[model samples]
Target: MTVTHVHSIDTAPDPVRWPDIARVPSGVTARFGAPIAARLFRRAASRLDVRVALPDGTNLGSGDPRAPLMRVHRPAAFARRVAADGLIGFGEAYMAGDWDAPDPAAVLTPFAASAATLVPRALQVLRPLVLPGQPAAERNSAANTRSNISRHYDLSNELFALFLDDTMTYSSALFGEVPARWDALEAAQHRKIDRLLDEAGVGAGTRLLEIGTGWGELAVRAAQRGAHVRSVTLSSEQQELARRRVAAAGFADRVRIDLLDYRGVRGEYDAVVSVEMIEAVGFEYWPTYFETIDRVLVPGGRVALQAITMPDARMRATRGTYTWIHKYIFPGGLLPSTEALEQAAAHTALRTEGRLGFGSDYADTLRLWRERFTANADAVAGLGFDATFRRMWEFYLAYSEAGFRSGYLDVQQITLTKGGAS
Candidate 1:
């Protein structure tokens, strides 16, 4: 039976939902702890332009009307979240209906802009005292990688299709200098993929290695150019769909989509490409990741990496903080700084050829995704995902977009060459 179908509109799986209701509470800590944490939040935002409104109609901040407003419906719950989970509680509070921000991105923008200065110098030194430890199980060890990847990637494909464009490119789409319409999303995604391919110098007879096979667009596109591509991924759901897409596009012979982790991948190739996959490599494993690429690539082989990056100082500050994103969205992920990449490259068999940051493009991409997701909220809930899940995703997308909007984060496509340039 030949399966050449492209896009099948399949119903989502009714997977077991979140809110581990079985877990036991730690102690009476949250009872008294939440209020103290709420006061700290008030103190932190006191100088920021944004206002955090209380139940009594009083607010915290500089009282700037131009700034975004956050309504705390249940300060106790919001504070309890922060007190117990630290950063994770912030987003959880929203899911629990403790807070409301009509424009999350807008409200978050000011906070994101002031992220570097949120804690004063005197207080920053006490961060170890204030912050919670990263979950030991969330660490991206060889044994634990697949579980971490599955928790997010293995979530129903139909859920993603509900919001993503026809191309199904989940990462940032480079919509170019001028703001493009929603219709240009698929094309923008192609542009982004094509740019990475072009930078990697993929063409006929070029043996390409893609570290993270998201779906099959990149593999199919590369194969269309007569390149033989071998893409690797750990996501079972992603691999199944990617392989199906590859077969559908008649690229089964040219493109091999393997369910293999980067740690175990074998073979040397002419070009290596990984789109926004480096974030999952973990800070401790960065060197080994680069080394793996170095070992797999032939001499003069080109490498193009599309990565989400944060400022060095911010990365330093939040690297160890178990945030909401780690808990609910992308587990075991950490955005690296440009300097971190350069520092790692300086010691590896790779040298940077070129780098392009498209943080604004990501902001636009996320905005469109959020809008689309919001528009299809009913359909999403119909897919067996609860309201809490929808709001969690909404916050994830908006929070990410805000990070880019505030220039606190960026997405860069860096081109590198083995043993320097050819």
Candidate 2:
């Protein structure tokens, strides 16, 4: 027998040759180690024209002039985790305290801005591979729905109330021309509802149905505009609050909020609207969702669907920082691609009338929420919630702001009218 000696890099430490490092998938391979990593780094450098204008330069690691404002960490098993699982692994690593960056938003912003960088990065992040099948769970079962909604909405209304506007609307971002005024958010939300109603062309006495109405903002606004409003939501807290608001506004008869699914809705209406709620319907249920909307919308009626949309198929499922939202904030939620939404409505009599994208505004909206939440932290904590809950919410707001800033998320208002029904 002949004995062969193999030198292990862990013991030898001669810059740890590429071959000695653990194997990683091809995607991560392009971003790690000397040769390939250097190429990728050079590409990023040239693209970003890497520059840091620091006065004292004390904020950066190593205080190296060439690497100002940049910190690099090469964890031994980091590449392996990112390569094998992509966003899921990366997120887990972040949560498990495996990775640290001084400014996550600043580090990710430049990469997000470049289309060339984003395309390849998205592909690398989304490349699919087969794995052993796990046991199937029941599809949108009642128990599942309750658990999903409760994970986030049922936490504590008082906590949400502290940060949210007076109406307690908990949907997509609100846009305003000015940033300083709190009423700007509320005004923007009402304006959004008005825009939806105008696009729907609903006149006085017209009947309207709103699916997933949060806090009755839209429903009450539509009712005030002289359109009878019927709204539905899964959250009992939302339903009760909305009901009280509607009654107080003297539109209890005109605006009705029901704690039910859209599929349970009956009667035909002149218009339909859903805001920021469609993401929770999941991709598998989009067809049913569209069908339900179409069924209750009368001939020649219009439907306005407002929800966050992914720019591409790769983003349809939550990724990176958004996985935290799925696990802790919005379990079972999935943003839909524009194509998927269009395809879901294909079988219906509806046709797209107008579309608007508000991806940038979401960044501003989230930042505002984070500031408000932080400002009112003491009051929110007084609502009998633990520190973990507060931290969870803070993390939620910060991570969401990061996502919107990165353009990995979007908010879209899609207007649809029944086709061939004029």
Candidate 3:
């Protein structure tokens, strides 16, 4: 069988000339096989504003140069991959080190929203599920959790410290009630937790269990409100840091941090709250997860389940880049559509009490994190991480922000109560 070679440009033009943009490095030209791919590159780059200079005059293409970012690989291949696979290919290529942009979502947002772009991609995606390996739903064992969390969360706390707020809360978007004060985001998070507690009707001296607690923020705050809190997490680093924070805040008597899986926790509590943790649990385990919550909550107890959920069936069909997130970020992770959540809870004793959608605010929250991350790049690099790790993180934040901006993602606050509650 003869090989059908496709030649493509490896990088954007050197900010020198327009027509010269199509020129590929000799090595890249030889690797990609020439004229056909070169023509493809020229055509694709012509359609995008792929070039920009940083304040210091560094040439960066396909993203904001001053920010931690990357440019898509040979514009032609990126076009073809996205035209064929939608966000999956875009993310896959980035993870595979094939191509990159300052923000992968910057490259993807425009493509995802365009009917012209998606029509071809939808057709191509349907042609074949080119991804190799088992689907996340098929590999639902607990063994997968360690590696998955480590890929993103196991990074040094020092690195995260550079980007996250002083409190070190790393999950979901914060809701800024004031919209003007810098502390509004943290205040919003506290207020949201307060709302969860109020909806649960859990008062002073109530016992509470928190699943997937990050940095013990909710637990610490809840304890301050007079609730006894027990929190669990899969990350050892998070466990240690949260324990320290809880102690520092002098809430050790009220807040307990247990390094255990959510499935193993056995207790009856007045209230159970899980914030942004369900997505990482994957769809295959939803039944078990919900059952665990139902089992742990006492009769008339409340469960606050906050997560980032997709809105509808149509969005579910378009699973974004399984490759990048699976390999580099949250592995074995799947975002549940709202319908899926309701279906999972249908047979359980838990009843929905309060539901609020905070999807729009995530874009702002992510943007803030991006700004914080950008402002602290030197501190991040000083943490002894290499360029690749930095690039991976930058890509993660920017792409996520873009996803929120495009409305392909959502952040939701859902409160459920046992039988006999309002």
How well does candidate 1 match the true structure in TM-score terms?
Answer: 0.91
Cα lDDT listed for each candidate:
0.82, 0.63, 0.65
- Superposed Cα RMSD, model 3: 8.9
Per-residue CA lDDT of candidate 2, range 1-422, in tens? Answer: 01111111123212232222223344544344324333344345455523432233323222344331333343434444444444433443333323333433444445445533532564444443311111123234444665677567767777788888876777555474656346588776666677777887766898988888777877777877798988888888778878988998999989888888777899989888888888887667888899988888888888888888776646543322234356556777778888888899899888888898887777666666766776786797588654345544655665666566778778888999886575
Tens digits of per-residue lDDT, candidate 3, 77-119, equal 5444444433444553443345654445455454433423433
- RMSD for all candidates, in order, please: 6.2, 10.9, 8.9
The reply for model 2, stretches above 4 Å from the true place, is 1-143, 173-176, 180-183, 316-322
- Expressed as tens digits, the lDDT of each residue in 344-403 for candidate 1 is 777788999999998999988888888888888879879887666777788888889889
Ranking of candidates on TM-score, top first: 1, 3, 2
Q: Native-vs-model 3 lDDT?
A: 0.65
Query: Any idea how many clashes model 1 has?
Result: 0
Q: Give each model a TM-score.
A: 0.91, 0.74, 0.77
Best by TM-score: 1
